[model samples]
Target: MPDAIDVSATPSDLTLVQDEQQRTKSRELSRAPFEAPPAIPGYDLLHRLGEGSFGAVWLAREKRTGKQVAIKFYTRGQGVDWSLLSREVEKLAVLYTSRNIVGLLDVGWDHEPPYFVMEYLENGSLASRLKEGPLSASHAVRITRSVAEALVHAHGAGILHCDLKPANVLIDGNMDARLGDFGQSRLVTEMSPALGTLYFMAPEQARLDGIPDARWDVYALGALLFHMLTGAPPFRTPEAEAKLAQARTIEERLVVYQQVLEASPAPTAHRTQSGVDWRLADIVDRCLERDPQKRVANAQIVLDMLEARDNARAKRPLMVVGALGPVLFLVALYWIASTVGPRIVRTAEHELLQQALAGDAVSARILASSIETEVRIRQDELVDTADWTYVRQMIRDSHQRTKDELSQLNKGNFPDAELQLAFDKVTNHIKVLEQRLAQADRTLDESWFICDAQGRQIYRFPDAGKSLSESFHWRDYFHGRGEELDESVPHDKVSPRTKTGVSLAYLSTSSSKYKVSFATPVWDEDQKTVLGVMARGVHITDLLDQWEPQIGKEGRPDDRFLSLLETRGNRPHLLDHLRIEEALKRVGTQERGEVILRVSPAVEKALETTDRLEDYRDPIAQLDPKFDGPWLAAFYPVGNTGWTAVVQERRNLTLEPLGQMQGVLTRGALSAFLVFSVLLGVLWYFLHRASL
Candidate 1:
């Protein structure tokens, strides 16, 4: 046990005790007065200052020192336990050494239960001052800083003033602050049923099985600051039930704070009663962050911010003089450009024109068509991988079925059965295959499309084809040689094959893999002269589905896994995973399997690279190395038409280890708390003169 110091400032007096008894008797006539004489102590009873749910505090003058002090007496039936009293005494003893903290003078049994003596304060608590109005921002900050400094010391000693509030802080004659009420304080690691006053209680402290931490004090400090600035705590209400409900969740309290901040008139616009700075209001807001993690970690940070704000204000004049001076000195430079710079430009242009000449039309047209094709291919490839795969598979299945039926007819195997039966079977199979083909065609027709060099449609997904140009002329194929034509190929007047139904076209001569007819120039074989333009298209949807099996196999439980390919541009095409998987199964049995095509960011980048267009860039690529878990993704490119794949997984399954680590940390914290409690008890006994 810790030692106790007997610093009772009030002198022994019987008159004060009788006066208190009379007041108590007047308040409650039914209650009996003490029949036994108040004895067994060397202290005197004094006039009662206030009574609360816990106990009453009295102002008394110690007989030995003749110093005025406040003595708090706990009643036997006041719902306080001996163990709780002992813990409170322990905390007060440790905190007494700090000047800003209310010092515990002595603990003695003057009546049925023990009472503790503390240094008396002349000025009332901050709560009493707030009864008039909210404090000016600077005044509140100054008071808060003093209390915070005391907390910094207490926390350093592993003690938390769990019940911190305006009422618990005393103002001296000098207006300096002294933090009081260690009756509910505890070591940082200790978890006690007695937490804090309802309004000041942290959400975690309200939990039945919550593990106490330093954050509890942090929250109370914020609440105190809020009260100082706003004239009330964030959740103060006339009804006790309402206050309790608000204390249940930190988020609800934060919402209230945000509403108050947003709705309340700006403090800067209002004049302060005390000549205090308004900037302190911002600091209070910061301290009241909804997330504990985002709050100021300690008192030091608050002090640092205050100091920095002061320093910046002090340096403002210097900044204006040194930096602003140069800008003002250079005001003449702007007018010089408008008045004298154009004549020199005309002279230079005239000299350069003599050296320049126009290039040949044939070579220029070919170059322009090649560049246009490349740009179109790149843009088409920017479709999402999942969408691309679905569209590709649909096209591939349609083509395969068509080819298979043609082969069957060529093989002459349909005449084996009776004439009626054989005809019916062939008709039924053809109808079913035709339906499949029609569905595939519908899907591919809706996919997006872009033509390559020689007027070939290198990327013709259904969505792309809907708006593609039908016909292409020689002039349309080779227009913009000097400038880059990286824009999307729009469906306008170009002629398309109605049977094949291509909606849009572009030319790409940059890569061999996707070179299309749009890139090829028309030639007359007999006359050996350039003729016109030819168009070609690649079924983009068919190519996308080709990669579905690989993605599905990589993520087992194909049904559970969903893949998507999105185009890397505005109004991108979508290829759903389920659609592609169905297409792959229809392709028949192959070991490596049919390639399911899907548009993805990777495909978009590959297309762009092949199209002689700038490569697609991803911002999240920087964060990928850190995120190692699986997720359902819905990613898209930041600027370019590039696809982003968003994958989502079960939260519990993904963060299992993190949960286990938290459990370990929780247990360790609890164990550390218990050990600290025992040490606290020992320290308290030695300091309070209760040592064994």
Candidate 2:
């Protein structure tokens, strides 16, 4: 900000100049309580200020609110009609904002005649100010720019001030202009029934039923600028003005308007003058174009030009700042970081740990919810594989045929050649049944198998060309010759088989391992006989691995790991053997004669209660030679499947909110400063423009 800008002083204080009669009329006073008809009943009439063509404006006080106001009363004798007075009020209702606009205060049409209640301006109109003398280029641009801003506000709201002129614009105590008098204004969507003051109307605006356009106001502003600069109307010559005045009715006026103003461009008032600003003159001339299309597009563009004029003059100090700002910003940023970075990091360290821990727990909980569905699917697979009666019939027929063949051979009822042929045919039938079973019992990590009531393996899917080397009865799920449950080994919860029913049993094929299997005894359709045991095994790790990426993008984070843990026994075991990459685990027990890694305390605690646990601290460097601690851990129990999902994380894995806040605040402050400086420079430019 420039030193000349009195930041301590308000904008209102700067606009008030030393003048007497002007100041007296501007003064406001409360009126004594009064009541009357044909007059504003709620207001005390202080004194009559001025009278327009149809109404009389008075400086008065509203008795109820006690606020000083300018009341324009429609005196029936002033040659005014209800439409003009009503139109003014309707326009103000839709278009108004900003201190630069003499806004509507209150209105009344309840009496014999209505009146306008509006914000009172102390400095009067620009026409009154111009009576003293011509304004300098700075004062002219500032005043015009202020009015342009008001026009922008009005146009944005779809109202065009078609009758914009010096008399309709009021200047306040701060020398800021306020636009008023919307009598001739029209909605942007409506055609004009009448033109505004002839001197200010654009060529198209003068025509009856003229469609509303933004260029109408542009022409008025140019006329205002021209009047401010040259102390005359914007017309090329006095003859052109006289010619427009000679036209009488709407039709005659249209002809003269075309002959004079629209015939050709002539000497504009600014061009005829010697000591005028060419830049401002050119803008005014463009606005006064006979063709509306050639004029400036909108009031906002004129405002931008005026603002740009001020900006161009005040570019000196801003250039200096632009040259050195980045260098200083970098240096200041470095200094602030050195002074405050550690404290910020310390405060954020604890928060980062908590966040990372939360991410771990959340990811684990998500993965845990998926386990029940997988278990159910495995159960369904088991039931589906065992439900085949054809395979069971083939096995029964093979056993029965073997028995018959042995008896026949013992009875010496067949020749050696005949016996050999019958044996080969039975073997081929068994092979065909094995191939059919293999088609139905295939998976990512499971195979199909069948055994006789004696625990001897009979059929296997992938071992179609070979014989079973081991009996499945050794597995716990197949205890008691695949029919009876061991007293020590409880029935599998998932699709467990009944002694004489068709249900299938699902259990761990290999104890303390990721291998799961479903087994059922193939029974006769009459429920009278058990054929053999049928089983399909799937490695649970394959399911876990397949779901990891789909759930929270597990294992993608450097500081985190996701593991599935089984919690069925005294201690939990990693289903996938997910241990610290290069670290050894402390084992507490052996499962199925193999030393296995156990779940961390966090996971064990989760299994005991609450299905979820957080805040496990393990040194990452110890876990992985490539990384270091402090790593946080969390786990979720997968719904009675006795498996848990555990997520791990380290300090380096999460975002740094404080550091990002620091950068945002720094850039924001720098941007705010630049904008503030430019505004102050613009205010300083008022002095330069005024001098010119």
Highest lDDT against the true fold, candidate: 2
TM-score of candidate 2 to 2 decimals: 0.40
Worst 10 residues of 2 by lDDT: 1-10
Tens-digit lDDT track of model 2 for 261-365? 655565455765554556677778777876653467678768766765667657767657744564454455566567776676666666555545544554465
Write model 1 residue lDDT over 235-295, tens digit each, in one string: 4444533433454344343344344444444333222335345555566655655444345
Q: Report backbone clashes per prediction.
A: 122, 6
Error of 2 at 565 (Å): 65
- Models 1 onward score TM values of 0.40, 0.40
**Residue pair clashes in candidate 2:** 15-174, 138-689, 138-690, 495-504, 496-505, 621-628
lDDT (Cα atoms) of all candidates against the true structure: 0.45, 0.58
| Candidate 1: clashing residue pairs, number | 122
